[model samples]
Target: MKKHNYSAGPSILPQEVLEKAAAAILDFNNSGLSLIEISHRSKDFVAVMEEARSLALELLGLQGKGYQALFLHGGASLEFLMVPYNLMTKAGKAAYLDTGTWASGAIKEAKTFGETVVVASSKAENYTHIPKNYTVPTDADYFHCTSNNTIFGTQMTEFPDLGIPMVCDMSSDIFSRELDFSKFGLIYAGAQKNMGPAGVTLVVLKEDILGKTGRTIPNMLNLQQHIEKESMYNTPPVFATYTSLLTLQWLKNLGGIAEIEKRNNAKAELLYTEIDRNGLFKGTAVVEDRSKMNVTFLLEDESLTEKFDQSWKAADISGLNGHRSVGGYRASIYNAMPIESVQVLVDVMKELERTA
Candidate 1:
């Protein structure tokens, strides 16, 4: 049986990408050295870094001006700190929307550097829905939010368009769906989720937001420093970057982010339909705020959970377990996942229904 991967991060990748990545590990582009062993300072590696950054931005349709994109080292977690460090000033406080684990984590980090106001919190209802109608204070530094709550299976489909600058940690759904690049002053995500393997982080920051902080930021945390170096201030993550480059090439060839978003919508719809239409199952997230990347559901009869696991695993389906916080089952339908894989899981659910 062909096993389908449904794990979240370090998760599914294009089969073709996997094959190419494995082959390159031994001999990169016939350069006669392993991709893992090469110097990140070499011309070949520098070209890899440059192309990856350029193509990633191009894929996002950030072609014109006023915006700069970088693939940095830390995950989005670091971005929570760096964003406030660079964008939030001494007197001004940044506003954040508390949605789930990652959003709260970002809030915690931002507090150490500057005053952070949590404008709204979804934890009131267990993070099943995005908060409705929040206030964005003008005097605040910038508004922050997590685009999608991966663990809770919720998404902010309608972004909070505060008149002030906006920032988001789009880690789980960065390139998975459609977004307006102009609305955000800064954006960051760990590469492990939708983009590539777990090394480089994608950051999109408006050029105007950099120098305003006026406080001394550590060089590594300074977005301007990394941007000025063309993301080569130190040794970059070569293999992960190469994977990201190829992924961008793949996205471009398949059509850009818009086309990919359409597919993502279809995939999420298909899975959610199965969950709703199937007997003995209930969705975890609120209907109004369901996530396209991560779908969490519960079985009507908790006793059958083990059986469901065995049945799916016996069919070679994998990674359906939910996060420890919200337990039941979660199907992480990330970008690389195909419709057919979700169909397999749905079919498995149907078979179980018939058997019961």
Candidate 2:
């Protein structure tokens, strides 16, 4: 039986991208050199780097608008520190909206560099809903938030413009939907979920937002230096970056973010309808705050967990387990995931309900 992948991070990728990536690993561009063995400075690899950066900006609709896109080494977790290190100063204050674990992590890092005000948080309700109607102080140097919560399965439907720089960690949901790209001063994502595999992170920043913190940032941590070097300040993750270029090409061929968003909505709606209609399961996130990328639900009867687990596994479903904090099931339907896989999961749920 064919298997369906729903792993949250390092998640599913387009089949063609995978095949192309594998071929490059053996003999990249028919150069008799594996992608892993090639020098990042080589013209072939440089072309890949340039194309990937350009494609990222093109997909976000920020081309030629003074926004630079960089493919870097650190994951989004490192960005939690880089954001504060480069943007928040000793006297400056930043405002953050705490939606989930990643948001809280960012807040913790920002507090180490400067004052960080948590404008709002849903922690009071175990982060089931996105905090709403909170005041973002105008005095803040920038406002930061996680666009989507992978752990709690909540996503911010709307973003607030506070007249300050806006920073977002879009790790789990980037390229999955369309958003106002111009509103954010910076957006960072680990290329593991929707974009590609692990090992590379994408950072898009407005040129004016950098060089304002007045603190001396290390060369590696300085976004300006990375941009100056054209993301070749050092040997980049050649294989990962090349794969990302292929994946971005695939997304562009599929009609970009608008097309992917439609499929994402359809997949989420199909699975969520099954969860709501089935007596054995119920969704975990609030109805209005549900994430289109990560659809989280739980077994209504905890005692039936083992039976349900076996049922889904028997059907060749993988990675339905939820985060430890949530203690339920999470279906991470990213951009590369087909609607048919979602239909399989829905059928499994319906089968469980009928058998029950």
Candidate 3:
């Protein structure tokens, strides 16, 4: 049976991208060696790295805008530590917006470096909404926020204009919509979500933001060192970076973020519309704050859970189960998820309601 994948991370990728990646794995660039066996410093892989970085900036409208894109090894979790290590001064503080589990995890990492202030949080409300009207400390080294919450399905529509550098973790929603990419001092995302796969993380930052924290950052955690080395301070994740390059190429060929955003909006609308209109279901996140990537919702009749589960499973729907913390269904309609797949889920929902 054909499965409609809705897993949150290491999620669905474009079918063409997957096919190309599989081909490369068997014979990268027609070379007899597998992509994994190639040296990171080789001419072919170097070209791949350079083009991937360049394409990332080009797609984001950040080219020639003093931004450097680095495809790093550790996931966004490492970036949580690297952010403060390379940006926060020995005495300087950092401010963060607590929007979800990952945002809270970032705050926890920052606290160990220096004073970390949570400017605003919706945690008390179970993170169903994004906190607003909160103040970020102007004196902080940098301000941090997560663009989207995958587990809870909340996204920040507007960002505050802090005089200080603004940092963001766009792990769940990067490249899915149009945004003012220049406003951010730093942006990082795990490739597993919308980019490529789990082994690589994309970090884009302004060149001027580094080498000012007054803390001696370790070479591995140093952004400037990685930049100077051109994202090759050590052996990079070969397969992950190449697959990400293929994915970026796919996006560029399909127009860009502007084009993908339209498809994403249509998918979100299709699913959320069903969740709201169907009497059997209800949305988990606030209407205005709902995520275009991950759509979290619940069945109105909890007693019908088994029937609904069986229904989706029978239809060959996978990864519809929500996180343990949320305890409902989450349909992660990422950039690559087709509207046709969404309609399948909506049909399942409608069928459940009719039979119940």
Candidate 4:
């Protein structure tokens, strides 16, 4: 049985994208060979690459900003180090907000390269809510922020206003909603969560922000290098990047981000409302800061988690278990997750409530 997938990264991709990806794997665009067999430098493949890059930038309306979009190999984990290396200068300090697991990881990695300042942190409250009222550095090299917290189920309601250039890790929520990119110097996200697959990562950087770090960054890790080469510095993750391109095409056909944002909000609201009203369940995130892509909840009886997983599986629903670090249940409702799927899970939750 095909179950509703709620895995965080490498999560769910649209069915249409999957179907088209499979067909391309066999023979892409009727080129008489499989996409996997095509040369990355081939004309046919190059056209696909250009289209993908164009669509990605077009989606963000990044035409006027002189920002270059790069679809590269390695997940966002690589970006944690690369962001600091390329942006954090020796004379400057980088500011980071400790939101949750991934944000903390970014902060930890940044310290090795330069002086990092923690502007705000929510660890004392167990990261249940987004921190409000924080100090933003005026002279910092760049301010790093995570738009969404996957493990703790919280999201930054309003990003901090820092005078310095803003750098963000949007790994889990990029392209999920509308946001102005003019305020950010750079934004990086692994494509697996919101775009398509596991092997590619997206980085959008403003032209003015590069070449300012004086430190010597490796060729592969430099944003300017990737930008100049158009993300084909090496062989690149051809298949995964193309799948992301196809996904972007699907998004455009579905009325772009506006239409998808409506659906995403509705799906999140439905699950969150049920968790809020359900007698045996309680939400792990604060109402104001809950993530629209991931709904996290806990049973009154923690011991029943395993049983809840089994029951949901028997009902043909899966991937609802929460991350181990912050455990109970996590329903990652990414863009591809349908409202009907959320309804199914809500019904299952009601059933469990009545039986209990």
Candidate 5:
């Protein structure tokens, strides 16, 4: 049977990119050395580093706009601490919007560094919807938000005009859609989800935003140091960085973010439509705030769970199970997920509806 992957992180990558990465793993650039064994400072790897950074900025329309991209280690989780540690200062507060698990984690980390205020939150209702009509403090150092909630299946469609520096965790939806890159002071994401495999995190920092915090940042956690080194401050994640470069090249060949977004929307609509129209399944997040990347849903009847589960499994669907926190079903349709796979899942749902 054909496999349809819907895993959230460490998820599916483009077939062409995977093939190229695999070949490089064995003999990178025909140098008879694997990408893992090559030295980080080598000229070949240096070129890879430069191209990946340039491609990221170019794809986002941020090139020549004072934005620098860095592919560093330490997942977005660590960034939960680094953002506030380096940006938020004493006698200054940082504002955040709490929408899901990751957003809450970011808030928890920011509190330890400075006076962190949650301007808005949806925790009262189990994070089924995105908070709105909340006021962002202009006097704050920066306003932070998570672009997409993977576990809760909620995403912020329109960002607030905070009138201050804006930071975002775009782990689940970084290159999946187009955004106003200039409005954000910083954007961080774990590359495992949309960009490539696990082991590296992508950080886009506006050079001017640094040095304003007035605190001595650790050498490892400092963004300016990484930017200055061209993402070679340390050895860096060699394999992951190379794979990410391949993926970025694949994206550029496929018309970049604008074209991939159309496909992402079509995939999400196909899955969510079935969940809404079918009697056995219902979507978890609110319609307006539903995530384009992770479409979470639940079975309407507990007794029909086994049958539905078996049906999808038989259709070669993988990672349809939701997060442990929210027990239902989640189909993470990332940038690399093909629409044919989505159509197959939709056909399975229709079959279940008829046979149930």
Candidate 6:
């Protein structure tokens, strides 16, 4: 049976990207050496690193915009601290928007450095919606927000233009849709969601934003040091970075973000339309703030849960269960998820309705 993947992170990737990555793993560039075994300092890997950095900026339309893209380790969790470490001065404060678990984690880390302000939050409402009425203090070092809440299925469709620099964690939704990438002063994302496999995180930031914190930053955590060394500050995640490069190349060949956005919208519409129209189901997130990447919904009749679970499993559908915090089904239709797979889930929903 052909399985339809819907796992949230370490999620689905393009078929072609996976095939290419598999080939490279055994024999990279026909060099008779595995990609993981090759030295990071080797010329072949250096070119890969350079191209990956360049292509990330190019895809976001940030090239020639004083932006430097770095593929680093430790995922977005580490960036929670690295952001404040490199951006927040000893006495300066930072502002954040609490939209989901990851955003809250970032706020917690920033507090250790200095004052961290949460301008607005929907946590009071179980994060079913994004807070719209809030003010970012202009005196803050930077304003941070998560573009998508994978856990709650909420995404920020619009961003506030504060006078201060804006930072964002785009882990779950990066490269899935079109956006004004240049508007953000800094962007970080773990590659597992939409970019590639786990183990590498992409960091794109404006060069001018660094070296001004007036505090000593450790070499490993310093954005300026990583930039100066051209993202080769240490032995990088060779396989992850190369696979990410392959995925980016795939996106570029498919006409980049503009093209992918259309497909994402279509998928979201197909699933959400079913959720709204079906008598047996309804969405969990607010209609206006629903995420295009993660479609979360629930059964109207909880007694039918066993039947519905069996139905989806029989159809070879995987990763449809929601998080523990939200009890329901979550269909994470990311960039690489085919609309055909979504049709399968919708069909399963309709079947449950007809037999109920």
Give candidate 6 regions above 4 Å deviation: none
**Candidate 2, residue 73: how far the Cα is off, in Å:** 1.1
* Candidate 2 C-alpha lDDT tens digits along 302-333: 98899899988988899989988777999999
In terms of lDDT, model 6 sits at 0.94
Q: Is candidate 2 or candidate 4 better by TM-score?
A: 2
lDDT for 77 (candidate 1): 80
The estimated TM-scores of all candidates read: 0.97, 0.99, 0.99, 0.98, 0.99, 0.99
lDDT of 1 by residue, 1-356 (tens): 44798887878888788788899899987999999998988888888887887776777667675777788888788887888999888877999999999999999998987778998998878999999889888899899999988789998888866677899899899887777777888888888888889988989878887788779888888888998998877778788888887777777777878888889988999989989999879999989899999999999998888889899998888888999888988899988899999989998899889886
Question: Which regions of candidate 2 deviate over 4 angstroms?
Answer: none
User: Per-residue error at 86 for model 3, in Å?
Assistant: 0.7
Error of 2 at 16 (Å): 0.4
Worst 10 residues of 5 by lDDT: 1-10
For candidate 5, the clash count comes to: 0
Instruction: Please give, for residues 1-356, the per-residue lDDT of candidate 3 as tens digits.
Output: 45899999889998999898898888888889788888989899999999999999999999999999999988999999999999999999999999999999999999999899999999999999999899988899999999999999999999998899999999999999999999999999999999998999999999999989887888999999999999999999989999999989999999999999999999998898988899999998999999999999988889999999999998888999899887898889988898999999999999998999
Instruction: Report the C-alpha displacement of residue 223, candidate 2, in angstroms.
Output: 0.4
Q: Report the C-alpha displacement of residue 279, candidate 4, in angstroms.
A: 0.5
Off by over 4 Å in 1: none
User: 148, model 5: CA deviation in Å?
Assistant: 0.4
Which pairs of residues clash in candidate 1, taking residues 3 or more apart in a chain or in different chains? Answer: none
Give a tens-digit lDDT track for model 6, residues 1-356: 55999999889999999999999989999999999999999999999999999999999999999999999999999999999999998889999999999999999999999999999999999999999989999899999999999999999999987788899999999998888988899999999999999999999999988887899899999999899999989999999999999999999998999999999999999999999999999999999999999999989989999999999999999999998878798889988899999999999999999999
C-alpha RMSD (angstroms) for model 2: 0.9
Once model 1 is optimally superposed onto the true structure by TM-score, how far is the C-alpha of residue 207 displaced, in angstroms? 1.3
Per-residue lDDT for 1-356 in model 4, tens only?
A: 56888888789999999999999999899988999999999998888888888888888888766888889887888999998898888888899999898899999999998789998899999999888888887988999999999888888768765678899999999888988877888899999899989999999888888888889889998888887887899998989989999999999999988889899989988998899898889998889999998888889987767767777888787788789887788889999988888898999889888877
